[model samples]
Target: MTTETKPLALTVNGRPVGPVDVPEGLMMQDFLHEYLNLTGSRMGCGQGICHACTVIVEGEGGALREMRTCITGAHWFAGRTVVTVEGHARHDAKGEIVLSPVQQAFIEHFAFQCGYCTPGFVTGATVLIDRLKRKPVARAELEQVVTEALDKHICRCTGYVRYHTAVRDLILATPGLVSG
Candidate 1:
């Protein structure tokens, strides 16, 4: 018996990745871990419900959408731009890695305990921030907005308060993310 494979091509972390051959039905989580060696997205529940394997995908109108890598097929991402947890940071003039504001806030706030669900949280929070940039949210609605945004992600070891507080504080502090 022969296994069927297809060429997979995509951009990840601002780098163009291959049209390399991949086995059919391979999940994006597996592809990231095995093929690309980018293991930041953890396989928490092997189901989409947990949101632990979420990655940010650039969508129509340049909108950011969170995708569950564990349940998403690798072929679905072909020719698309995907951002894993590793993609959030940039390098400085001295080549030192700089964390995105969300990551920095999470670390400073101790938002995560085990950090298994952190990657998904970061991706989700990023999407929210990006969305707010395009259309700022009202300050009065900020708490509910943060809650709805992160409600889907499950943090088994760590509770949700810290994550919620960190993201909320970050959104509140950022100049244009929230409006009066």
Candidate 2:
């Protein structure tokens, strides 16, 4: 008896990659880590609760949402665009990588201890930032908004204060992230 494999073709990290065949029931985490060597999204709880396997998926409407890759099948992402932690950086004209503001914030605030959950936190923060950009939040409601955006992820090292602070700081530092 052999496990069946299915074809997956999707855009990842701003690059078109793969019409690769992955085994049926193969989690996107495994596909990312094993096949693509993208080890940022970790399998913390293996359940969606931890959200250590979060990745951003751009829907047809251009709305980006965080998805748990640990339980998602590779085939589910077929034809969709996904951005992992590696995709969050920008490149300068000289071809140098510039870290995204969220990534820079995390580093500035010392947001992670073991760093196992940083990727998920970063992804979630990026989504929240993007959302806020489209529909700016009020300064008064920023804390609640940040809490709601990041509540799903679990970080054993920093007690989440650092991550929360990092995100809040990022928002505050960026002009027009919130209008109040």
Please give each candidate's TM-score.
Answer: 0.97, 0.94
Per-residue lDDT over 56-122 for candidate 2, one digit per residue giving the tens place of the 0 to 100 score:
9998678789999999988888899999998999999999989999999999998888889989999
Q: What lDDT would each prediction earn against the true structure?
A: 0.95, 0.91
Candidate 1 lDDT by residue in tens digits, 60-138: 9999999999999999999999999999999999999999999999999999988889999999999999999999999
What stretches of model 2 exceed 4 Å from their correct place?
A: none
Q: Please identify model 1 stretches exceeding 4 Å from their true place.
A: none
Model 1 global lDDT (CA atoms, 0 to 1): 0.95
